[model samples]
Target: MTALVLSLAAVGVILAFLGWIFPAGSVREIVVGSVMVACLFANAILLLAGDGVVGWREAWWNVLLLVSAVLAVAGGGPLTTSVLALVDRGNTRAQSTQKAGEVLRGGALIGCLERAAIFASVVAGWPEGLAIVLAIKGLARYPELRSPDQPASVTPQAVAERFIIGTFTSVLWSVACAGLLLSR
Candidate 1:
């Protein structure tokens, strides 16, 4: 399960890089959405299969993942954002075209954060990390967020920073896991 989660993350990361660098929102969203779905299934099957890993701790994280997956689909969160952005760039106004980049960049950041957080929560048994990831998704949806002075560079690294920061959530999650393991 962990391996699958890691694999999905790795693939998503690569896709995000490709998509962002090429300024191609179409390919980026497709890959990101696929990653989330794959992780959701892998996580669920891994838990349900009962390979001696299922427990109360895991149950909570699974529930969170379920909720996340549902939200992801219903709201078209990352998937729609990436696709729409790309489409807009191809056939839309200048502002909309630029906005697409913001959305994609933000979506990429959120996608990375979400996966990293979920993986961390699963391994570390910490739901806060997951919650944090949830909050980040909203911020990644815009162009000016922090101080409202962010430029419109639309570079991959600029967007990837959000993912990198999100990846740190996993480290914090590991700390939580260490604490839990020690307690046990």
Candidate 2:
């Protein structure tokens, strides 16, 4: 059991680094997806093998859950960014070019903060907080989405898609991370 715990921790560390470095793409996506799936599987295996006790002491399990939660939150933003970049890759619209850096920086920051909050909320057993966070996010970004004063570099649809896709990705990743922790 200790060996399994340590191995998962090691894998978590490596995956965290890879996520930090690559953030997105086929490689990043595959690695992140695989690690997440493994986490889920590990929890199931432990539960089944231990007859619902999970076997590990509270401290050990807590540490594992904490580390996994942090890794998932940290990786969520970059994964979202990478996926969104891929989604918009073929878009040669002026909106994709103009102020792209600014938009990306802002979006990434929001994603990081949002995912962190969502992850914490779920882990702390406050699922309702997700609604508040998402509501605030939607309200905060609504004006930009509905803005009629479009410059050549911006489009309402693009902005909306960015918000929608980014928010969904961030929230889903956080939820999956939380679910993994709860599984065992």
How well does candidate 2 score on lDDT at residue 62? 78
Candidate 1, pairs of clashing residues: none
Question: lDDT by residue for model 1 over 60-138, one digit each (tens)?
Answer: 4454444433333222334434544544444434335334245344444445446545555655566686667656665
| Strongest candidate by lDDT | 2
TM-scores for every predicted model? 0.35, 0.75
Cα lDDT tens digits for candidate 2, 117-172 = 88888878998999989999989877666667656676666667777777898898
The residue ranges of model 1 lying beyond 4 angstroms of the native Cα positions read: 1-23, 27-36, 39-43, 46-91, 94-118, 131-184
Model 2 has an lDDT value of 0.67
* lDDT for each candidate structure: 0.43, 0.67
